[model samples]
Target: MSAQAQMRAGQGASAQAEGKAASKANPIVSALHQMAVSVLSEQLREMFEKADDILFDSAEKARASDEQRLYLDTMRIVRVQRNKIVQAFQEALQAALAGIGEDEAENAAGRLDDMSQWSLEDGDVLEERIAVNNMQAKASSLYAHELVELQRRIARLAEMTGAGLSPESMSPQRIIHAFQNSMRDLPVDFPIKLVIYKLFDRVVVGRLSEVFVGANQLLAVHGIEPSLDAPTPARPESRRAPRGLPQDSGVPSWAGKLDRATMGAFGAPATGGAGMSAMGAGAVPGGLAARQAGHLAPVGGAGTYTDSMLAQDVAQILGSYEHGRRPQAPAWLPPENVALVARMFDAYYRDPRLPDNLKPVLARLQLPMLKAAVADPRFFHDPNHAARRTLNDLFEMLLQFGSAEAAPSPQMVGELQGLIDAMVQAFNLDPATLRESARPEGVDERTAEAFLREQEEMQQKKNRARVERVRRIVAHEIRRRIGERPLPSGVLRLMLSGFGPLLCLDYIRSGVNGASWTETMRLVDRVLDSLRPDAGRHAEERAAEEAELVAAISRRLAAIGFSEERLKEVLSGLLQAYLELVEAGAGRTGAPAADTVDEAATAAAPLPPEKELQGLLSILLVPGSWFTLWEPVAQTKHWVRVKGYYPVQNTVMFGHYMEERFLQLRATALATALVDGSAAPIDPSPELQSAIARIGELSFERVVDPVVWTTVEGRPGQ
Candidate 1:
């Protein structure tokens, strides 16, 4: 029964057992087995490192934690490695079967059904090799599980570390307050909460889907990452106190010392007077970090409280934008937040710096990105204002700033438009109106054809001369009202272009975020206050409202602190209001709101409009009918703006902007009229003739000649 004799005779069970015993007894074999196990673990770790890069975001701080990282890496590698070994073994087995004689192959595979470890003797040494492979695979799996457990330990340590984390300073009491406040603010039956509950309930039924598991797991994993960075000491300050701050003891074994620069900024953070476990006993003010397990325990079941409907709507809008929809247009989007986003973008692009305090919050919100896109000079500098040309333009471009999940996913404009359409639907609007409104923009061939056909019908009733006579009468009537000067004519166009946004306010409110329309109207009223020719009442009403908004801004701005610069900022904001209201006004009919007439929204702040505007408009009881935004040339930023929505370009879209456009139309015609004796010829050369012709035609085309407007005498000539 010597082992060597048994191996030489190895053909039966007794010989096989003897061979196993010899293999165990031999030092050389034992050393080789140990070497193989080490090799397997190292390979698994390497595989995991690659997978981690693909699976999760790279963390600057987390990379240093070798123990935690290595374990996770190994586990990932183990799974891949195990799967690879199985595939190879299966392929080898199949190939072997194919190579065997036909009858032998059939018999061999059949034998596999009843195969045991002992069956290796029947198959020869290949079967024994496969058995060894199985054992190694099992060992790797066990090792991977151990790594998972170790990673869990690191996560626990992260929470225990007393190195207080957050975007701002907070005491333990503050933390409690913040959580309570956040929880209390949560909607009583928020859809997200319900979804979380549903997920939890489904877990018991074993129906939890992979997506549910994945999103929830992602939220849970973030618990270990710091929400905020602790303030670090300045290099100069920390140089003196080289050994100032100590590492928090409860932190993972990998968390060593705070860098020299970070050591002396602030004292260690205390939680409930908890001693520092992150440091050592009696080493810091805080005894230990707050136990985070209590905080992280599923607040509301699985915490999948997100609304699928909202998400779907958002996703659709986002997708539409991705497919080419814009949501960032200043006028088209019309959200105050969108305006703020635009302004923020301009400032951010100009400054290209962010305050440290805001960075953490910025990380959570994707607003910064929209601003960035707006600031991207290469794309945004087009004189055509093409970037946010439409709502779809803004929406589609919004995705560029963040990952898919973090992108701004607005709800569909059409879905919101449904609310606008609700009226047309409910009232059973006429098909003609629908057809008119639904046509494509810029070039409507069908409309042109229809117009041409109608013209032909008119022509059938009368000759070209008769049509010409009617056109002259129409032009004359418009000229009589719009006046006969170019300056006033341009003013008319500017005035009329401003009113559409104010009127569209109602239409916009029908969309999903339109509940804010009331607030917007209030802002608009502040802009419109100075334009009214007279004031009967509601003057006090307007003043009170503007005051309230000012007070609110003051209180909020106070927290950010005040300075001479701050005063100027507030005053400039008011000046913008004045420009939007009194300074921008063109032509007005009714009495202005008394309170808003006297003051801009921030006029009370230091450096009031009177000082800056030289009290020019201040003395005028007129607040005036014509607020000249620009003289000679329409450089809005360079010239002072007069009251009204009429920019140097357009105003009629706001309120009575079209009335001005009408006046400008008339004025343009009159200005071109002959002062018979002054010029060499009444008519200029073809080039000048073409320019004037185009202008006259455009003005005539734009004029409002509704018969009723004619009845209001001096409507344009005035």
Candidate 2:
């Protein structure tokens, strides 16, 4: 062969070798790359097909000639360019995957430059840029849960493979960029492009859960941990010095017998004949194995591990807390039980969720709880134990009435103080007194339950009345605004059926003078003005104004709980109405028919069964369910109780036990908060039960490395 031919062959051989090496280096990345390309290609094809149907359906339903023509033209262009779009998207996705580990700074800079270029370009480019951002935000909110799970799995894979990967590597931005880039050369206007983008969002982004699942499964097959365990902070070093039993302590003969029985129960060989010497010399095994052997069984069928012989010991510890003194765990208590209680309370004290004022209140319970745990063998093992139940109820009540940012009301402070004081005073050897003091006003369980139910019903009635008042205010404002200027029938319907409820939400959240109310009122004026023809303005300027009005109105209507599909329909009708008024060269001909305004106000179109059911489900806030309320301004979470659901306004009213005013959230906004992790439902299980489980987990960790607890003796209030 000639030298030139040999050079060409060598170059080809080098490229093939590099490909093999790259594939061998990270099989996981290669698998993921292939998976993404295949899924996106199929999704793109399906998205176009769905877009065709959506456009056809929209065109058929369009009320005005102009609106129908726009849909038909967009559909035709999409159909003709479908193959090229899919191929472009496939190439873009492949390129994005290949660039996963590249420097993110350069990519971000490149994006910034591109955005600058778009701003300097014509109006269409700017419109496309805004559309992309809006689509990304909507998709992210819609698929937040799936995206989070996918991100966790990807991170695990990256950790195992020593590869750099992130959620951004496979974000919807890539899909959107690729699709937008493909359409950059198309002849469609911004409105048509926007319709296509929405369809793409609905079809492609909606099916992202499948793509995420596929990627997760592939990573799982590659030995990556599929389940993500939340990272726990390292246990802090103990501050308290370890205390051992005193050698010269007074000890009765019966105590010696009890010590021997306890050691025997733990499988420790009792030696030196039942005395302090036997207890000190015989090392008690401290773990699950020792517990399984019934180490805490009552000595000689007595009611508690420590008999009346240790009553004075328990009293000394309890009195320390009552008198504002530092308390220590009794030496007579088993080390394992002491360690468990200490660790549990330590965890509680360190928890950021617990309010500061309540910390001292909870601290007072430490000694009493430790005493109860020592007396009851089943304290840690049984979740339904009476003492555990009482503790759980008390902890929950404290959380309900307390706020990290807000001061507790005087009534709240008094009630909680009284309950804690009663429980501390009444708690003796028997745990029954703890249960009695946990009830309201020290009443019996049945009477307490009845009283609480009645209080809750009254709160619900108050919430409903408040919501009705807000609704009336909103309805009156909307009526007055529309009556100020003559509006087309369609505009009147949109105001009543779509915008009215959202105004109510705004008024409820922030009063009539608030920013949300002001912005919504501005949107209402824009909608009214857009329907009138502008004789002097250029066609392009008028079109741009109309586009802005539609986008603003779409966002406002979305706040009233319209689904994406329903929103498209509403916008279509709105656009058609605008076109008819413009074509007739009439501006504010007359007020809408009185019957039309009244009917629109009173009768909204019935929601589809599925939509109605979803709305209902979103408002199903069971009373007493605790939610972490996100205050964006304060950047803090406050515990709030689900007071009641008001179906008339589709709102959930949240109450702070210390605050008389309730915080009402529309169901849509609440659902969005939950999806974005701003609001999270706390575990409804008993707090004490959860703490015990954590203690068991900590114990297991200690068992694996016994030295972890060598210096950490149980210090009750430390």
Candidate 3:
């Protein structure tokens, strides 16, 4: 037969196969997707029903699980889940459509392009939450004014719709034309639906292009599959000493490609060993119970490689002496814990990205590994042994942390600290250990340095751990309080965890909301009422932690931010404002009407700063376009002590606070509205003067504003 005739027969067969495959697969995928989405939407509808029941019912039974008690919690969880399912639906629909014929997919794409007319997620879900809490007209107005214009742009393309044209005639921007015609009443501001629709449009457009590409290429014209080519796996290197190279006595027996699985992860033979056992297949090592529990006997390759598997395997082989109870461990014995420490050390040594502060901890590994090598009398001359030993030392530090707020373990953080202090001293004594440890043949210098840095980082972490523990306690307390839960532990620890000392200093120096010393004491008293509300109920272990926290905070405050000098200055300024304002209102003896209080004087010290506040709070919750004033000192301190000192909780609380404060100030300021709306003669009392002076003083840093020196200084927004 002729070649052209043979090709025709082959093409006919291929077309028949493609047609049959499409008929089988297309409807199946579409049905699966439809079913999944239907189920998900039904689940969502049920959730909404549950919420409606909660909201409308006068009395409802509480759930036995005590979960999702908050209204916000229920709404948030439901909404987020709905969004996840929505995204999944979108992905599935697009994927299934990709399996359809090219023309059919494009037709579907045209329908989805009309999504610009669909209402997606609404911003009211977030914005309305802000509006409801803002009772003061000032905050409400500010929020209303500082808003995004929800406008929609409908593109109407000019297509040739002249005589003799088809009835389906539409412009090049046909999608936009359809959207405009579909709108009931378009918004004046940026359109949220349009933005989301545009994203979907891009995906469809890409798909359409791919469909065309396929039609123009192999899909339109039959193409042959190319033969496959791939590199063969290389054989494992032969196990033989290098010619003329001296063998190190300590080169461990299972060193090269040692059993991948220790404890059965690598599938090592189950021997009933500590870290080494591969699950025992038969009996020689151990019975069924142990192997099934994953206590594996050490054997050759069983699974994926774990770098530290051998170290643990070796340590188990050495046997557990229970803290050196053996009169004298074998002359060749290494500390069992050293294996863990060595693994940690090796990782740190190999990692160069470690910061400088952590080098001390990284340098700590040399001696432990070298000591092990010396005892074993192997790898005496091998550099790799030295490198591996270095890592062992570094791993010691990595294991320093895992759990939170637990009592310090002796072998992990405690013993290591002492050993580290001693080891560095020895290094200082005889620099020769560097060479002695470096004698292991296979290691690199950079790895050694990385190990050193890792160690230093671990030490820094330990030092910082004290403060972090306290912060954790505080965050837990706040989260618990907001959830209306019982206090978990002493409140003091919760306060001291992260930059805990620094925050305490801020609290001491600047009493909350510019309260007077007397007022501050009163607030503290009220605060202390809850600080130990669950007193005498703490676990013995937790009680010790709380006491430790209180003492630590007290002691650490002296060292924080120049011994509280910053605190006293800010506090003195704040207290004077408080007392002066009190006197201005009611002679400090009589009951001052809330109206008599100079609203500005009542202004809380700008904390967490104005810029941060503006960035955090929505306009709907504030009095003016401006939200919070960023105090220069506070901003600086925030950056220095913590990368972003404004905690999310602080921002939330301060957002609520700013709204209230803005309303108070604006109430009096707005009085000018009665007459020509000119500036009101709001008297600046001494207290107000003090507060303003303090604010300006903080902003200026006891120096003139740099802008004052510039030609454009007086102009706004420069």
Candidate 4:
């Protein structure tokens, strides 16, 4: 038998032995083993029953002879070796479960050794492993909530039973690993294996929720945290403390001062006044507003008339505006506080930057926000206050719909409207409702921040797939073009490692048949040809040809924002390879020492100022940074927020601010945009901050317009 075959057989034998030993040594492992056998046996039986039919259908529909043959062979192997495969899989699972809490470093070292072997003899094995990892990542994301709950329940069960079981034993990574290990000895090709893995993912991993439910039930029967509820998603940690406050303050700098001001403003007793009925204060029992009137009643008040009266008046006035009536602030209420909220909404309504469709949705929040501001002074003082954060999150979510040139989908508009309606209905005197509305616990459907996060995750997934596709295309193209062409090893390495990404970017931006792609391919061929022997050519002719080729290469690299220093290094390497080829043609050994070649290739080169600037901008333009991009042809500016950068594609993804469009710019394109004044970064402060600043610019005495007071008091504006 071959050495590789013998090694794999020994590994399989060792795993089976470990599984048997663990079953004998640990009672917990025995229990888990029993459960896994019963559950997985039934699941695998169902899976295999359908697998043959699936393969037959695929073979019938196959477009190529090779594809049809592959399916037929896979089906035949599965039919013949069904029982053995199942037993092997069960054993692998048992071993994996038993090996929980084992040294991770040991497993990592084992994997490294396996990879080294695969590199030397079987690259298909490495590719299969990569495919499994990608499948596992996708499954983990799709069932994230279920997996988290399962981990929690398993941890609790372990704690109660005095078992050393780890939550990771049931992770997608481990589950996929066991299946891959079982199939390692099968005589199936990579494509067939991938198809089977997909089926396994669908049948086993997709139904992991059922397994989790059963495990939770088992734990509950043992009285381990009985009646376990769905786990709450943990809130992301705050990146920074409330703006303008000390990190360790625990309270805003204006908290105490605001408290004193609030008390003084609402401390006065009720005196029956002419505007009381207009403000809805007369609707209260005994014509005296209580602090606990309803959800809209301001909290933390001493039942004073001014406190509840002010909130009720704001709600009544804003409610009138909904019915096409101009809102008039109550004449007896504190003008400064009323004017602050009024001007804030007015600014929001008038702001041309906000899309027209979103204005009505935002307008619904005026009364809720006013009540929150009255009840909690932190709403104004702390930028990170829940209410302010919630508002900002909503605005950001709406803004991701591209620029005004592209319209948002009706479905997205409906979702936004629904969220606004829900928030308006739930909000009261407390701002916690705003936070809750943004990130609801125990809810099936995500609304504000959670919904946005899911969308961003999906976008990132698509971007990653695009990058992978582009890389595969680039690799195939390079191999096809370099078929059997003997070139210097250093030059080949430079083409693969250094210039490959630039080709990928060109393909991503302008597809396979584009002029840019053709030019890049031609340049690659020229570089390869420059290192070949030209027996009939004069020395000067060869030198001139090499010089022009180097210049062309430099220009191509420089256009992609490569630093001059890096460009010089690359050109020098190519020239050295050319000289070596010439020496070899003269019957002299020409290969440089390995160390010398390594230094020339691997040494870091300093970036030129422009390239350094590009790197700096790439780092700073993280997700959520806003920029205005100028369209020269349209003579218009587009507002976009950075979604992310994909290094493999050399692309930056930007989501438009007013519509549902996304734009991806290559690194060179982005750097050009910045340098040519076509793209400029902008500070998009939170909606509340801009309003507060606008209000600050107004004179304190005339904060409320004289005309508004006159109209509310039943007089002409004059």
Candidate 5:
């Protein structure tokens, strides 16, 4: 076998072993396994039902085969579920990590701790239960609106046709058409058009007006007309009987065939429809047509609707038309195209690597996809349609957002909304004309497969290009920082090994988001300090650098308008902290203690500079820290203390803060120059002042959290 195949096989074997060992230990894994088994059992039962006619001669025979089928199905399901659970858990964990910021040391640590404690039997179960409840609540809200609309529309239709429906004509196609006609006033690209179309599926609609009820005196109290309970005519002759004729023996002939006609309308026979007796359409209680119609109708009799129901139905239908439940394929869009795009999103949504929250957002794209297809045939006809490419870009953005812990930023949300809005507007311009325009120009089924393959290859190429660009950017920045100093061979080797690729990917991201120069420099200083040889000369040089940093920072602050006294105070405090940090590192600070020469020797042993540097750099250069370029490591002393600054959570916010400060410093220096008559007077832009005011208005707490400098239990070497 090839090396890749062998590696995969080994991994599979190892994972299986691990899962077996942890099955009893991890309640979460156990629950997932159990859920998988349950799903498989239901699937097996379905398979058996499908094969009943061919595989079993009788009920007894079917029962006899159950054990064998169950055993086989269970074996297969266990394997599938194992793979699924491992992949899904890994993906969820990674996505969770993506949201944490470099300076969010506490949060990252807490997240890991919580993850470690997760048990499907307890913590996750509670969350899942909560999620389920929220989903139900949303569904309920949607249902209420739908129920009202259905009642209103049905009532209007009933009034128009004297409260009766023609069963044979209420085919799925016609019902969909009726709904479409009713919503003619709505915008062509409205999302509810898709929801209404989806509900047209026969399984969901299920005999729209079907009803059932008892034949006895119960009908009297319910005010259900006896003739309304008439069943579907089992014989053609009964159907052909005069409309006024009494089909049921219990009905008086004088009451006329309208009762039999009513029975036919309800799709119920006089003897009752199957298991039901004289239950009229109104008596059917509730059906899928009711429950699933949460967006359209309530659980009510199919025969009649009240004014309240009509009002509700009208309200919901209008509400959906105005504010869609989700994005959908636009009207006049092709089903083939809709299905193709839907399949793509479904694949992404179902992928184990993606977070679950993303599914709803991804699913909304169906409508937009359909709208795109209809608006420009090239979206469906060409392999490299610009619209399709844009969609692919959006998909990547969505994945990135999903991977993070924090909610997507307002800017991203606005961008997505604007994109969708533009598409809908373009689509609405001439929906009628574009209805059939895309199909004839589109690729045929045979070519479609090839087109999709080519597109997939292009997508892969794009991803590779992106990674390479980011990698180059990171390497450039790191090299620039190192300047004339030759990077140690060991450090270079570490960079070239696995570290470079990952770090570059992260650094590029930070750069794109606009990492501040101060943050970048701090990271460089930390890495260099950790790795630098601990010679006596280097220690003396570090002390000089510390004094230099204090002076430089104080100068910068003073230039930005800090009073001399404040600058001196800040400088004095920082210098004292640096001294303590250096002394602690040399084991010359802290409480006085009696120690032998051996103890001193041990403390002063030749520092394994390379090893210590590697350990420190490895800890701080983790991927999560790349975005913010700051992370806290557990240590006894601040080995590389420069300034008491913490990284912000986002590059935009960081850039904003830095820019505002720079502007202030620039104005200060310019004013000083002007007073000396060495420079021209400067006038501040009104916009700049407004921006500064807005920045000032923002709470410091919202932009960044302070990192606490604390002495921990152990240092890296210790």
Candidate 6:
């Protein structure tokens, strides 16, 4: 009937023999078990000391009087329970290594080599080191949690006694008395003494920072057995360090309090009201302390709210961070706004049209949205609020622009800009203020907006116009190849539109040698075959085509270090757009809607030449490439002649030479000149050359011939 009899009965002769063998074979497991037992026993002792007499009537008095028969019986039962727990751990350890190979066991156990001496060159060794550190951290955390619980109990006991057990005012005698009375179950080692001092240190700086004191003295004398000394008076103002303010000295006198200072910071009290719990009834405002000290039931509470309701509110406030979803609301987010924003973010996150690359941008909007909601809840709270609708539109517009390879059309940009300006004006908000609130460091709103515009202009030069130039050259080559046959203009245009941006990107990423018409056409043919009308019906077929296009473009993108998942998605979207155009031209339009054409059923329409040019300009402006000026050399005789040249490094690829293999011009220079349509350069000087680096061949032939020239006499006509 006794615990010892039961423990002995549970472990049969065979089981006891196996446990003994396991403990001896795995000394590491035995040591770990010993450590766990020591910690658990101390924790049990603290729990017994903290629990009110109502919970276990004899706990306090029984433990103190070991001479009593009742106390001896309790010890025997505790010892039996402890042995059972240790034996269970030993059995678990043995089971874990039951099927492990000798080498793996040796590696896991740190038996082959002392882990501290293992070189970190091998990934396996590094991982083992990390695993060891993680285990140590877990052990330390467990120890710290128990210590925190003990400190909380001590504070509660002090409040009950009305003696106010302030760590700051406690003498060596009091510290030793508390340790002997409360922690006698723990092994009296330097490690346990240090941890006790660490607990006092955490209380001094944590939520209880304003209440508990004397960490500096305790830390100074930690790890040494205490000698009885007279208790000091209440703490001095100068001796108490305020929370958040650093000590004047680089290191606080209590700096050596804990090995894990960061962990201790979190252990601070969560509320400023915690100090009231440790104070006397007179110290508490009104009867707040008395209420908190007693069973924490409301004085007039009945059935106002149920436990389930409170739980639901807590869950809603916590957001979905635990479920592995992103855009989680901050812990400080108000409960009312939590569900609304969570639902809104969920919808945006799930939209298939939203690219993966723009998710981060969408997430960043969460904080700004929270701030705005706080500023004006009515604008954000209503599902159909105009401001909310405008914000959604803004996010979509940004996603579209950020996702595209080329810049958006000038008209489109103007429209969005107007919308943005209108939204701010209509809401009576300041653009500068909003920008300052949301913008991260080093990212100026004006600078980013300017960069986007520059992209539009740059794209205009290199994109459509330059692509057209390549198309014309390709067209000429095709015409020559099939002498009298009519040109396959439809197929050629399809190829050019679908693959042009990729080829241009390739040319820019590497040199012109990296991409050629011969190679580009080869990939284009594959795309064309996969995108045939019949193949479009098959999801797998379309996916294959998308994969091929992405693979081709990604190779060059990788070279330029622009290998983003969203880039592939954008290319796939473009392919779909082009295929829809070709399919529409083949008269494959489905039924029309009563009010408007179904978006999927409608044919894709080409943009007007001006619009397309604007779009092209937008695409060309981006992160890389330097805008430069190349002045034409002049020769004067009877007439003045200005010989223009594109000075380019052989290594650089220009947009105009997308189809050209042997030579590549700088897209920035050619694009700038084409946009201006002027022979006059920005004027290259030593300072400018050093800034932009103009070290290349003066390839005059690469530049387009001039339509107008200046005469020696400064006349317009020659």
Against the true structure, what is every candidate's RMSD? 35.4, 26.0, 32.1, 26.8, 29.6, 29.5
State the C-alpha lDDT per candidate.
0.27, 0.50, 0.29, 0.52, 0.33, 0.34
TM-score of 1: 0.17
**Candidate 6 steric clashes:** 18
Residue 568 in candidate 3, Cα distance off native in Å: 3.0
**Best candidate, TM-score:** 4
Q: Cα lDDT for residue 494, model 2?
A: 74
Q: Write the per-residue lDDT of candidate 4 for residues 1-718, one digit (tens) a residue.
A: 7897687567667766876675545433454555665577678777888888888998999999999998888887778877877987876676666663245423632574464566564577566765676656555554444455556656775666566667656665666677777787777677877778877877777665445444443333233442133233331112112235433222221111111101111212442211121122223222323423432344554534433454466545433332223345443332233334443443333222345555445644555665555555445445445555555545545444422234544643554555565455545544333323332121122222243343323322222333443455576567556654444566766687546766865665456778988998988877766655667898889989888878887776654435456666566667777776565566535565332322233322343333333334444355665566767666765656677876557667776552335676675566556545466554332221222233334322221111111232335331
lDDT of 5 by residue, 542-614 (tens): 8777666555554433322233554454445334444444555567545422211112222323223332322
| Candidate order, TM-score descending | 4, 2, 5, 3, 6, 1
User: Candidate 1 overall Cα lDDT vs. reference?
Assistant: 0.27
Between prediction 2 and prediction 6, which has the larger TM-score?
2
lDDT of 6 by residue, 273-342 (tens): 1111111111222222232223222234354532223223324332222222222232333433433343
Return the TM-score for each candidate structure: 0.17, 0.31, 0.21, 0.33, 0.28, 0.20
Taking all chains together, the TM-score of candidate 4 against the true structure is: 0.33
Clashes of 5: 32
Q: Which stretches of model 2 miss by more than 4 angstroms?
A: 1-24, 100-121, 226-718
Ten-residue region with minimum lDDT total, candidate 4 = 255-264
* Least well predicted 10-residue stretch by lDDT in candidate 1: 674-683
Candidate 6 CA-lDDT value: 0.34
* Tens digits of per-residue lDDT for model 2, 525-556: 77755665556777678878888888887766
